[model samples]
Target chain A: MPDEAPNDPKPSAEDSPAKGPGNPAREQEPAAQAASEPEARAAEVIERERRGPSGEPVRSVTFAERKRMNRRELLKLVPLIAVGAVAIPAFRQPILNQGLRFSDWTAGALFGRHRLAQTYSDREVAPFEKFPYNFYDVADPGVDLEKWTLTVSGLVQRPGDYKMDQIQAFPKVVQNTRHVCVEGWDVIGNFGGTRASDFLRWIGADPSARFLEVTCVDGYYESIDMATVLHPQTLFCYEMYGKPLDRGHGAPLRLQMPTKLGYKQAKYLDSIKVTNVLLSDMRGYWEDQGYSWYGGL
Target chain B: MAATVAVVKQKPEETTTVVYEHPLVVRIAHWLNAVALLVMIGSGLRIFLAFPSFGPRIPQQNFFVLPPRPLTIGGWLGGALQWHFTFMWIFVGSGLLYVVYQIVTGHWRQVLFLPRDVKGLWPMARHYFLFSPKPVVDAAYNPLQKLAYTSTIFFGVVSTLTGIVMYKPAQFWWLAWPMGGYHFARSWHFFAMLGFVAFIPGHLLMVAIHGWNNFYSMITGWKREPEYLE
Candidate 1:
């Protein structure tokens, strides 16, 4: 194929390194330096006609060079083989974690923060009988219901423990959305709770706080991005299927964020610590092991 | 007269031709896609191991057995997802760019299979399987090649669309609904990767049979040819 650049004057100039004044190969051609466009065109045509169909210069490869190439090709496989030898076991998590912050930044840029998770009608919600035991790390420790309080701390003016009634007093928003697990199972359910954005606003949370550090009763801790924390679908959920969350479910409280994978929706009522800086050492129980921290969709 | 004689003497004796089999963009996209597919398959296998069975956990073995645990990328589900979501963009970007390049350069004519190619497919298949007689090949690709390439492109499109469905099923319910809901989309995504796994060995074998020169063309965008009789 003819070079596309030859027709486009700008690209022909940009592409040819020899066009530069400092090019050593052209330094001897003082007369050629002053050569006009027609001369250059003629030279280009001559060079083009001399080349083969693919624009590659026809050349002779000696037997010795071809012999050496076999070894060279074998040598090329060395790094890939080395990576295969020790990629996952030795540095799986570390290598996966590398450039994760950048990945998150790119995802944020591409997907944007304001986009909402898809919602379904109440009828589309899957029946509980079909697929049970969907979530992992289920913990329902005995607790005094009256004495239980949902604590809100860190980067908030109203940073104090509030009773279940106090939490319930806030206006409720009901959503029928699919809960997608990282393990590749999903179910639609009717989740009722205060919108997370509203809750963040109600708590007088600092707008500048970048993350929400959530701790569960089972010692399961996870940090969610502020964008997700303030997502319209993200909820401090307490009701499932139009009833108060049962013991098997996260009673009194659980995060019902459809945008995230199942693991990110931490069950069990616990303290929420909002902060500007992310946890440097630990991100989450699963995230520390190598999971993408964002877990969006 | 002396300079002309010297130039003639300096020229090599062997008359050879080099065909530009691939453009620079195609070459770059080809390798980018290879790396992207490798990373995706590795991490996707890890993701699959998180829940090996479809319905519920059953100990009984089926026809398809997964590679050993260590061979798999499933040490950590989170880590696997990390690798999967990250490299997914690279796969999407490179694949789309390749399609765009083909369309823009009118290279799709050489790749996309037409009804007329069906007549040629049987002969190509017979040549490969029966070892009857080698059929005349095209300068770029054969009919069988066009069919395979076109199907693989379809596979890639489905894989990416299924990925989106899995990623945000709730957000992209319209996409998931046509695929028979979330679970179906997941299965489709898994199977598409399997299609890639199946396609790769056959692709490599063909390249091997075509010789190292064929493989080298992808890297350097040039193919070696003997001098033709005018």
Candidate 2:
């Protein structure tokens, strides 16, 4: 509202000199009258003398010269048309998924990896009802704390399953950040976790690996890019809002990715598989259906 | 006086004259806008379809319908978002340049709506509806065109603001508050997109009605005209 245009008199087309015969005032203007007489005389002379090759002057003006989309212009459009034809299908999900990768690279480069996600204070937390809870499964199949373990495999030097205590034994980080959903809502939560970078390093994850494929206990699988996996804010969350995570909140372990959508933060994380393999479609659960794979800010 | 006088037939020679309607910068900006807006709308629809409603319940009276599976840009939400945010720069950058150029060059005076233009709205509408001859105004744009072009700018601002708020509610929380909240801002963003999409068809139809010279003017920045004296 503050940016509303200031009230100013605009010059409409009708305000132009001599819109039509209906404007008697414009016709009576001495300046307009003075200007029109010579123009009218010139028009009369041109009308009489001007002729096509056959000798009759054109009555209604035809923009034959200007209207034509000449061959040069038509040729110029061919490359554009071809690019559009290719880009149309290329941008879609399954086939020719080349464009998304380019878009990803461009956005990733523009908003560099170091650029931090916005943090928030307790007072700014989104209202409770606005907070969304999304998961792959119909019910939260509560994990047994005594038996559950996080398995690290693939290109990691330390390829083994570790109990919660063993995982929590590492350094912990606490962050208060906004969790944005792909469905267009947001919620703020305090997450306590170990820095994923530290954990990956602790486990000796292959630095050269292109992807870190994570599978949740709920059968949800997602492939994350190395740059995002090592993002400073990316966490292997164990606690939410101070207390340990509840059953519905991915109790044992969850990936808290502030840079990504809620869906990208795979819950009840069961395993982390670091690999150099780049799948044709590196999509998460929702992404495979039609959600964007790179749901970053 | 007799020698100077010349008789004219049914159609006058006024149309033979040529007018420089669209300037070079304006033409470039116009085409860039067309491409950017189309991509935004298509990918935006993909984003919208994911949630598809303002609230938990779907709207009872659904009018605008996309295909069961339209050939949308940006494959998925992540892909669509990349496309959306990437082209967002193009949209915003060009839009800012266009607006700044218009204001700096005094072209805003010709396009911006004013109280005076209201008086001509009905007449212009009548001219279109009743098939009456177009009034030959010596300005760059007619009253109706001025209104449409001006409103599009307003909608563009709305879309941009709402989009930013939705993108980062905590960062732009102040902007989100006036829109009622984050979800409301998203809804408003969707509505703004709808407003823009609705405007496109009407705008294209008008261009078609105005003939090839009108369309060519946007591309070549030149319009063949008639220097008619009423």
Candidate 3:
């Protein structure tokens, strides 16, 4: 087999470093070298050949030697077999979980502390009717609207139940922002609420708490990272399109973070806890099942 | 392109020659990427099935027929996401390794399709499709083969870029600007998958038609009596 350099202008066997002076083959192939050529010139020719246009060695090896070389090359690829471990039932979940966790960690790291989610103008907001009511269990979890008070606990200085008016006491913020679902659908809707940071400060919640865990009127629960909890756009939403929350939309108070997936925005807020630790088995409703915990963006 | 040819003599009149083809790095990256692509495509289809449309949630309009269950991987949406997320790193890693290696080694000239290759494409296509006279074999890859391989890099770039936007739309929102927005990026990501779907069958068919020695070369980095060499 000739070592052909298709586009290469000069092809010569002398370029091969494998043909060293000590090699018997070099002595046997001495016919190519001119007797009149000085040793220094001949050495330069060999050096230039060794560094050929592509710096690729041009050589010939016996059939048996080729087989050995092929075997060695094939061996180099054996590490790729480790990727097949995902096929095993026991290993699959753990490996995938690690991958998801890594992705979540990256997402969390990429999340800007003060950066706000993209806000849209009023005209760009999706029609109220167009916003689909997505829920895991029921769209309208029956909550006594008048009696409903967000039960605050954990690391907050104020650990008592608070009425909707108390949450509404903070200066109101209204903005249109896109809400993305884990299923890949998205809608820009008008949301009215107080900044979660302001509300956290009012509630005397510890500013440095690592996570804010929340439960819903329904069985669904979620834990949010403190960085997101303090984001200006993270809202304890009480109104949508300037109307008080409807039963279908988590009524009294629900998390309305523009930066988080719809699932992380727990609706029909029941209790809130500021804590550093999350129950291993109970991260979030969908997250425990498989969804990424850092449902950022 | 650091290829070596070796000849072995079995008898006085019998001699066989073998040529190194794929480098070890290329072989490793190729197989790793092959596995990653299979997982990515399979799991991606399952993820797409959750919504199956680019339209709004209300008055939803599905784009096409749902992919058959057998064709998809992972049992459910969440499970499919796990597979997709897991293999994404591998896909990107292998692609980067292959590309960086090609560039650093200056081996890209062997397979990268350039403007100069445009003229040879018709002749090669005619040879393959119309059963015309075989074009003279010279390089490891012909113009059409170069085009096919080169297009994959384009598809890979599109897929990875769109994937990043979809994965971190808020953080990488600027990336979506060129493609229009997050919604359009999703569509582009799906289309990129379609590009691979279109390429796979033809790629496999060509490999099958080329026989075992050709396929073995990818694994062993050597081809026995490659026709181009003859």
Give me the candidate number with maximum lDDT. Answer: 3
Candidate 2 residue spans exceeding 4 A from truth = A1-96, A112-116, A123-132, A136-142, A154-157, A205-211, A281-283, A288-290, B1-15, B20-32, B35-39, B52-137, B164-184, B201-205, B208-222, B227-230
Q: List the residue pairs that clash in candidate 1.
A: A54-B20, A118-B170, A118-B171, A290-B79, A291-B78, A291-B79
In the predicted model 2, the residue pairs found to clash are: A290-B76, A291-B76, A291-B77, A292-B76, A292-B77, A292-B78, A292-B79, A293-B78, B14-B226, B15-B226
Superposing every Cα of model 3 onto the true structure, what RMSD results? 6.0
State each model's TM-score restricted to chain B: 0.86, 0.83, 0.93
DockQ each: 0.25, 0.17, 0.41
DockQ of 2: 0.17
lDDT of each: 0.68, 0.65, 0.80
> Please, what are the lDDT tens digits per residue for candidate 1 over residues B1-230?
12212223323322223445567677667776888788888878777877775543323232267756675554566666777766677688879989999999777877898898999999999998899797876334678888888887888998998988877665566787878866677678878888888889889999887776567767665454422201
In Å, residue A111's CA in model 3 sits off its true spot by 1.0
- In model 2, what lDDT does residue B215 have? 76
Per-candidate count of clashing residue pairs (backbone under 3 Å): 6, 10, 3
Q: What is the TM-score of each candidate against the true structure?
A: 0.77, 0.67, 0.88
Tens digits of per-residue lDDT for model 1, A1-297: 222222223333233222112333433342353255433322222122233322233222222332343345435444444334325567654555664655666555555467777788767777755434534344566556668788899999899998887777778989888776777656777889988888778889998888999988877789998988888788999998888887677776889888888888887868898898776656887887666687777
Model 3: CAPRI class? acceptable
